[model samples]
Target: MLGRTAATPVNGHSANNNPNQLALPVNLPPGQQSEASIVHQHIQEISNKRISTLDYLRKAHEGRVYWFNTLLFDKSDLARMPYFDSRRLARRATNHLFLGLSLPSVIDVGSCTPLEFLRSLNILLSEYDAFQQLHAEHGSASSSLSRARLPQMFRRSAPGSKVRRTSNAAEVGYPHDGGDGGGANGTHNNSETTAGSTLGGGGGGGGGNGAAAGSAAATASAISLAASETELLPGEEYTHLLTPSIPFEPDYFETFATLCDVLIDTYQRLLTLVPTPRECAGNGVAELFTKADGKLRKIIIQGTVKEFEDASRQGVKTEVANVAKVVLGGLIST
Candidate 1:
């Protein structure tokens, strides 16, 4: 085959040159090798941090979905109570506000690209659709039912019962221009005046006086009963209801606790791979170290908060309180 490709040179060098004359493979110095290793380590550290950040985001999103299911979807009887419906609406609004505020923070720290961000938002929207399905299925149609009764209910009642109707003209005197103030009857058109004068200028004096006294007495009794019942106001009851009970949702707590454990484990692994400052200096890996450090700190903070939130949901008030104390201490120290 073309004289065996001209009997190709063994080392691809001129046949005249000695075998020893062939260039030797370059050997990196120990320092350079160390530097390379450090660079590799730093890269691994950053990659690990990025992975952990993604895990955090995924866990947080999952926790949000679980929270929605536990708080809103699970309570079948919640729709029966008007107060609960109002509370649910308020809770939904509050959750939306918190999520909107916190989501940007997570995205910023994670450095999520636009497509990734949109994907996360889409997941949230899908979760929201599920939440709305629960709401629609359970929500009271009181407003619609109330509206249907409006016309007949608003119709004036016959002369009887608690709410009495009186013409505004009779209540506050209006000038009558017609002579004698009489209609077709021989009777005086001053029927209202006659009734008022006969009662010593008090149309329903006796009955009105008794009703007022009874209302005052009843009000006083109600006040006393309420005072004796509890020192808390109705609004206070609502506030307390919003405060999650300790050991609240055991399953929710367990789920987030597992997530926290994963974060801690990942963080430890990342720490092991981090390059020292000296190592970082020689290999241009210093920036990665700094980034990893920042990300680690953020992960710790967010993980702690998530743990606390889960604990609170499970009615582990002590843990929640401890977390709050830690946060306060951090703020104070800072």
Candidate 2:
């Protein structure tokens, strides 16, 4: 007991104030960080810095005009117009650029597996179908719909914007490449030929069979015929998905459409890349995350931009459009 050092007092309480409580070290040694931990910390710091910089930039230039091509043409009478105003044009261009860049965060295409992608795509596709139906039914001039149908979150326009602006349906440029029609799958093309040959061969043998055997053969033939008409090859199964009417706000209609556009475009591109079963089996999932560049990337980016243009014309929801833009860009990049 004499060898033990006296407990030092800290503020009003001494270390010995609570005899039952085990005292903690005043100067605890720092934890030894693993290589991975150090790397993680470094990455976290970098990410935080990047986020801070972006936030600062956003706040700094919130309503400023950026002269992308001002020297090429002088400010005209049209510049005074609401749509043609310099600040509005600049904001649109900036939003469009940011939208493309934010796609990675929007969808995280790189991390998702093929099955996950397909499932996500199925949801978006259904939503898009429902939106189209809603538009057809209620988005007409004669339809007395206004902000009443919109959700409370989206009914009111942002400050400084007009309450009810005229919207024109703009033409969307979908990738219409004639060669991209799953002809390369080979299975789809030969299905009819193969079924026809099987039917012909089965019918030839049915004539020689006894009454009971003939009945069985006829039943089998009927089943095969039905299957031949309805069956889809692997990977082509998405075509059979029944798009149900999912109630969504008009605010999200454009977003759904854009997502479907990207998903379909990406799937089509993947189909072209993987023509045979063996090749598809190996490269199908791997290629989904491949960084798309060169001409393929360019085409996808252009399509995304076109979606934005169409959305803008159709009274797009600003927040949702931004999210869609990011998702499409991410998909193309991934």
Candidate 3:
């Protein structure tokens, strides 16, 4: 109540239009519930400020999209042109980042454990498989495909404004240094080497005594063969995950968009618990609210601007402009 009393209301049209601006929890639709939404409700309830995860993400999505579009988008590619103008990819990526950082639906944020991360990862891996299938079938040339459904991303760096593989992919850096496969407890590697064996029996025994003994021997032999089928070395059980070496379509950015959706759904369900900050009352659920709320904290990027830009890159200047706007929120053009 004290925090609520100290909070001042933001009176822009953004605030005035929403009826739940004053409510602790924005009313959910008929029988619908979202854990991320609930966490946001608590933040608004405690902050005495008109803050909502939904609202915050909207602003962030706007910024993220602006930056992505400004940096990516092939002017000559007519099919991709609409997608670039639409800016849906930015929103989609922001959603995944937020979900990945938040607590899941059924569980509270505090309950997030190492096991939960693995579960979340498994879901994303499944998403990767599905995305690959879709691209394999129709390619990014499919008219129905959205920008958010792409397989690759337009990173901030590189030789020109070319798109690159995101970290979520198995071979993020084109040529993978395959010293070790997935050791993390997420999923199995590129091949699920399941071993099986069979047993054989002979009918040579003519009498009762010989028949029973022959059957026993045959069964023993069958068991021995089955045991030799697949023998994994020590600690190899959890280390093997199938990392599919799927090549990317020309429009991989669009592919990344689709795959990111799968990751968003899975990650949004996980709950990561951290100690409550002093300014905000402990929601008790331990989600990293800051991560969920902040925008432009991208995961699929690396290197500096100078390191990645080259003579052929025409869009680096525009990319710089987009980043400047993100910092200023449409303030200046220097």
Candidate 4:
């Protein structure tokens, strides 16, 4: 009985050097009870411990420091996460890394672990690269398709010559009498004879017929010139006309509208993520979390939207640049 305490032993015996000695009854608080009375208590404790371990595992899996430390120090499973589809989390990590590095006021990213941040950053970068590749490939394909179809878009000349016709009365102003000089009243005309003599004594009627023929030839030449010059240049006016007045080619409009829609939708979605100027400044831990969250959202949204817009803009510029190449090629081939 020297060192024995009034507690139950596993074998229901006290440490009194006697196998048959029973343990003494212990003093109990109001809620305290024997081990058997607290049913499943050990199991509950083990379950809680398991939950805590799982939580730690999840945090490590999602953390930026986990990735960085693994890469820089441990060389573990940093490469296992599928970065392409996990871009949202990756983007969040990137924001944290930059904020930690660049922001003077952000002395420490409290509670936000480094491994989680790095993993998110890696995912975001992967997504951005994928998007860039897609945009480039799409733009190249679109340009080639447009170039292939450009020849069919050449506007043919209008059905007839665009020249204005002169009046028949203007062409036949003088009478068509024989070479002998005569006036409209059937009288001998000295003035008309003098005019005719200037043309080697040709009759006035011959001069009139010659003048009419020359006018007709001039009209024909003018019509030919007009017809040759009537094709429209590629410009706003031409675009407007082509949009609705001409045949609606699905390819042209579909590509253009898709680009515009991507730009506008991205912008709209980004606007939702940006914080107001007031929310950017605060002190409390809760307020700081809110601010950080808002800022992170804005950064991710803006980055994504800007990337899309830039891609679309570059695609359009490339398309335009290819127009000259296609035109030159057409000219050479023709």
Candidate that beats the other on lDDT, 1 or 2, i.e. the better one: 1
Model 1, span 268-310: residue lDDT tens: 5434433332223243344444543454444334544464355
Q: Model 3 segments beyond 4 Å from truth?
A: 1-72, 75-251, 267-284, 287-298, 301-334
Total residue pair clashes for candidate 1: 10
* TM, every model: 0.23, 0.19, 0.23, 0.16
Over 164-243, each residue of candidate 4 has an lDDT whose tens digit, in order, gives: 22112222433445533332323322223334444454444453354643443343332222222222223312110111
Is candidate 1 or 3 superior in TM-score? 3
Listed per model in order, the count of residue pairs whose N, CA or C atoms clash below 3 Å is 10, 1, 27, 13
Ranking by TM-score: 3, 1, 2, 4
Off by over 4 Å in 1: 1-27, 64-283, 299-334
Error of 3 at 199 (Å): 38
Against the unseen true structure, what C-alpha lDDT does each candidate score?
Answer: 0.36, 0.32, 0.31, 0.31
Estimate the lDDT of model 4. 0.31
